[model samples]
Target: MTQSKEIKKPSSGLAARIFRQQMFIPLAALFLLALFNFIMDPSFYRISFDYNSVGNPVLSGNIISILDAGSELAILAIGMTLVTAATGGQDISVGAAIAISGSVVLRVLCGTNSRPDTLQAPIFVAILVSCVVAMLFGAFNGMLVAYFRIQPMVATLILFTAGRSIAAWINNNELPIISDPSFGVFGGFIPGIPIPTPIFIAAGCMIVIALVLRFTNLGLYVQSVGINESSSRLNGLNPAFIKFLTFVVLGLCVAVAGLIKVSRFSSINYSVVAKDIEMDAILAVALGGNALSGGKFNMKASIIGAYVIQFLATTLYKFKVQSTALPAYKAVVVILLVVLSAPKVREYLARIGKQIRQKTHVKEAG
Candidate 1:
């Protein structure tokens, strides 16, 4: 008789996958909050279609609105994920960078004085100029962090403090408007489409990032540098170059997000274009279960975290909570999730579980 070896079946369950990916806490919190909202108001999950004042078909519902409004944050989180992974630092100047980019768009659309003559500027020109300027700004930050070895926060803070003021100078302190119906298509919806265009833009950006990371060594290099810069250098990877490129890519994200924001209103306001959004983007990256100390990262988790933050804020608003108090509510939920996901807490739980199993096994044996 021949001896046979037994093969075990692979575990493929939702719980197993969640645990394996370390996403159990975030996913569980997401579902719990969603269920709570649904229980409080059965209509919370309901979606309905309607027409806007312009006679275009539109999606009208809380969930739709949340995704639509959260697109910018989602986009920013993608860029933030890369920067955090490569440089082990978050860009706090994203809002300012976008403000500057939006202002560049405005200057292109309406010129220095924001006159109708400037409206003749081609939309492509405006977009291109904005992207270039944003990239330059990003490169500036990258130079400081990569070449000068300055702290990422301190390097970016320079732009953060002066960005809007620079925007004011760019437009000569006058608001610039695109004044084209076509411009609204990017911010709102295409003709005859019920979905918001920003959603598609965000999705497209995400797909591009995923493809780039999937098909190239860029992701590997980033993580390697993040984990150990000296080791990466020894392996022929240029950490400085990688870090610089990360910021440049993030600049692209800021440009795209700024375009959508300005397109939404067809104008740029230097004072409030992307104010305070940097904090939210950073929070999204952190909440996505990425270590702020760098090393490994998951863009998908950051994306989910972006949606979670938006959903939490939306739900809070639905519950009649004051707008000012929404941040506090978010803090409570985020704190709970973080605590539950802490390594120490998980290890303690595992110890207790093992003890229970041991006791049960002993009793069964007896």
Candidate 2:
């Protein structure tokens, strides 16, 4: 009986430790949000849905928008996570890639001279073309980084600035409207609920990526190469090939996210569609509990980070204390949140908590 108890105790402790490290930050953030909202307004728990309104009532009252914000983060962070893991690098041109994706779709489907109703292409073909363009761009970055050993930032930086210019050149820096029935799937809504098509697309991407990384030997190869390229190569894993592949996938993700952005706005402004979106992607990856050094990547954690960021933004706007300084406020909160969210820090607290409990029990016995 004693031996069984001991085994179970250790297992339980290990599980608790794991949950605390992974879940604490997101849960605490949500708790703080609830407490703050409750303190500010007693009816913070209020929830409602009205589907019968004539001019189209929101299905879940913007819940889809919150998820949509997270979806953008998920797509960008997928690339960031892979690159950071494989090559020990960060791709700063994430936003630029996204701009190119949206711009290409708009220009091809809805040219500046053409109305939103102009061009009609199959969705799969459009997506495939965008993915190819994104892959070429990402491959360009990989060549520089892998062959010349350039800083990942600098290598991607070349495209980061130039890519936007190229997108603007295509669009004449104007917003192009999207009216194809195929494109409309992205923003379609069921009577009571606004189904953000982008959100579903993003979810599909997450499923595909998760499936790829979880069930394949390729996942093992990338992780081994990420931890140590030389050893992985000696063991016959090709680091160069993995890095190249990761960037290509990253670019594809950026491209899809861009398409969604354009769809959401119903137009593409080459300049405005993806400004500073790279920051959101990076922050999402970090907030998802990834280390700056990289080795492990967690899709679910990243997804949560995306949602958390959006949640914070929405919570702020809902309070109506809106101001331009909100970004600054968000920055500060994120910094603090990130610090507290560290796995090491969470472990330390759990240790202290266990010690304190032991002492309290001893005192009671005495």
After superposition, candidate 1 runs with Cα above 4 Å error: 1-17, 115-118
Measured by TM-score, the strongest candidate is: 1
For model 2 the TM-score comes to: 0.84
**What RMSD, rounded to one decimal, does every model reach?**
4.8, 4.3
TM-score of 1: 0.92
Please give each candidate's TM-score. 0.92, 0.84
Please report, in order, the local distance difference test score of every candidate based on alpha carbons.
0.85, 0.73
Question: Which residue pairs show backbone clashes in model 2?
Answer: 59-192, 59-193
Candidate 2, 198-269: lDDT as tens digits: 677778998998898788876677677778888988998778888888888888888888777776776766
Tens-place lDDT per residue, model 1, 163-269, is: 98998888788887676788778899998999999999999999999999899988888899999999999999899999999999999999999999999998888
